[model samples]
Target: KYQRAATCLTKDREALLAFYDFPADHWDHLRTSNPIESVFVTVRHRTVRTKGALSQKTARLMVYKLVQAAAKGWRRLKGANQLPMVTEGVKFTDGVIDAKNRAA
Candidate 1:
């Protein structure tokens, strides 16, 4: 959303420092729930491309197999420890290491 919704802040240092002194949660980056949902949508599209009806039990097994493969792929992505995509666009004067530092 940051790439698309570029918000510009007009506050000076005094006001900006006062605002960020409050505590904020940092859980958004650690969650994988949305990424998994995106993977599911892609897989569903692929599965539906060449499909036919099946017995209820067979359908369940097919879904399990497909999801097992997906889970394995998700595990392989655990090494991606880069910073989350920046939102609100942090501006740097100099020596800012991360977004939090610049925002402060």
Candidate 2:
């Protein structure tokens, strides 16, 4: 039963372990990251409560406003400053920049 799951994980081992290539400060965020789920939870609750009362357009508008409002209270990522380094192709190993691979 678990063999398939284990095989899938083994097949994608490199990608799964790629998390460690990010900044150590971001580990917690990476581990628990689910911004879409968190943001949509309120939307789902409110929409379900409304049942069929809302038109399709109204539902979209409400979801948009809800997400906009949620964005205001969202927490910023830790080690956000390292984002540029990462984007610039900086090499990280075990959550720290690899000095040997660093560009001058």
* Model 2, position 28: C-alpha lDDT score: 83
lDDT of each: 0.50, 0.86
| CA shift of 33, model 1, Å | 3.8
RMSD (Å) per prediction: 11.0, 3.3
Q: Where is model 2 poorest over a 10-residue stretch in terms of lDDT?
A: 46-55
Show model 2 residue runs off by greater than 4 Å: 1-11, 101-103
- Which residue pairs overlap in candidate 2's backbone? none
Q: Give a tens-digit lDDT track for model 1, residues 26-83.
A: 2332444766796787568656974853777876777777777777655434323322
Work out the TM-score per prediction. Answer: 0.38, 0.75
Worst 10 residues of 1 by lDDT: 20-29
Per-residue lDDT of candidate 2, residues 1-104 (tens digit)? 79999999999999999999888988988887588788889788877887754588987888899899889988889999998988988889999989876655
Best by TM-score: 2
